[model samples]
Target: MALNENEVLAGLAEIVAEETGIEADQVQMDKSFTDALDIDSLSMMTIVTLAEEKFDVRIPDEDVKDLLTVGDAVKYITKAQA
Candidate 1:
């Protein structure tokens, strides 16, 4: 089954909360994972790994640039799942 933006967002929220110690409720689609959440490269890599496992999507290293924001992550994973 293909993933949707809302579903991606929810999954990402859980990932972000677990990885960054940020509250899931505070994870907004408009927020930037690096700027807003202070997710460094290492943490982002971990997030990507967990997201790939959780959502069954392969987020290539090159594609990592496209997932700067929460909404960007949702869109990328949703597309990958599709």
Candidate 2:
């Protein structure tokens, strides 16, 4: 079964928290991953890996750059599943 949007969001939040040393709840949906979470390129790539593993989907490298926020990541994963 494909993961739902909420699940994707939650998973991403967890990944962000684990990788960035921030609390999962601190990650707002609208907040920029880079600015809010202080995520650098290496961290972002780790997030992409975690997302792909959790959702069982492959995200392209080019698309990774576009996922700047939690909402963006959710949208990308939801779209990929569809």
Candidate 3:
């Protein structure tokens, strides 16, 4: 089943929080994963791997580079689900 936008966002925030120790509530749409969350590339890759397992979506490495913000991830996962 495809998750809605809010559901994707919530799940993604949880994944980010678990991986980086950032509060889920702090994972807002406009926040940049690197600049705002201070997530390094290794952390980002781990987060991506976990998110792929949780969301059952394949986020290619090339595509990942384009997903800069929280909203970008949420939208990509949501679309991938569909």
Candidate 4:
């Protein structure tokens, strides 16, 4: 099955919110995960793992650099599904 961007955004928001202790409603697409969520590389790796498990998409460590914002993740996940 293909991944849904809306679903990805919602799930990613929940994941980030849970991991960062932030309100999910406050997670915007343009927000920088590092600056906004204050997540480190380890946390990012955890997020990547969670995304892989949830969306069944492969997010290489090298690709993690491209996922600076929530929108980038959404785009990558959707593209990976295709």
Candidate 5:
């Protein structure tokens, strides 16, 4: 099953919240994973891995570098689901 942008974003927000303790609502599409969310490389990797599991999509390490903001990740995961 594929998830829409909102669903993906919400699920991702949950993951980000769990990992960083940031409120899920704060994980907005414009928020940068590194700057806005204060996610380090290690935490980012963990989030990516967990996202893959949750969304059932494969987000390659190389691709992870390109996902700078919450929207980027939501778009990537949404496309990967297809």
Candidate 6:
């Protein structure tokens, strides 16, 4: 099954919540992944792994680094799936 942007956003939010111990609703799309979600590089790597597993796609390291916000992650996932 292909993942849409909304699905990616929701899935990413779930992963972020799980990894950071934060509520899913607390992660806004516009918020910074580090500043708002308190996600460090390791957490981001976990998130990338989760996303790749969920979507069955590999997100490149260069692309992963650019995903600094919820929207960016969603967009990256959508593009990767495309």
Report the number of the highest-TM-score candidate.
Answer: 5
Off by over 4 Å in 6: none
Candidate 1 per-residue lDDT, tens place, 21-82, comes to 99998889999988988899999999999999999999999999878899988988898898
Please, what are the lDDT tens digits per residue for candidate 3 over residues 16-49? 9898899999999999999999999999999999
Q: What is the C-alpha local distance difference test score of each model?
A: 0.91, 0.85, 0.94, 0.85, 0.96, 0.83
The TM-score, computed over Cα atoms with residue i paired to residue i, of candidate 5 is 0.98
> Which 10-residue window of candidate 2 scores lowest in summed lDDT?
1-10
Candidate number of the best lDDT: 5
Instruction: Please identify model 3 stretches exceeding 4 Å from their true place.
Output: none
The TM-scores of all predictions, comma-separated, are 0.95, 0.91, 0.97, 0.89, 0.98, 0.89
lDDT of 5 by residue, 10-72 (tens): 999999999989999999999999998889999999999999999999998999999999999
lDDT of 6 by residue, 32-58 (tens): 988877788998898889889987789
lDDT of 2 by residue, 1-82 (tens): 7777888888888888888888998877798988877889998898899888888789999988888888898988988887
lDDT of 4 by residue, 30-55 (tens): 88888986789888888889988888
Model 1: lDDT equals 0.91
**Which ten contiguous residues of candidate 5 have the minimum total lDDT?**
55-64
Q: What is the lDDT of residue 66 in candidate 6?
A: 84
Shift of residue 71 alpha carbon in model 5, Å: 0.2
User: Which residue pairs show backbone clashes in model 2?
Assistant: none
Clashes, model 5:
0
Model 6: worst 10 consecutive residues (lDDT sum):
1-10
Pairs of residues clashing in candidate 3: none
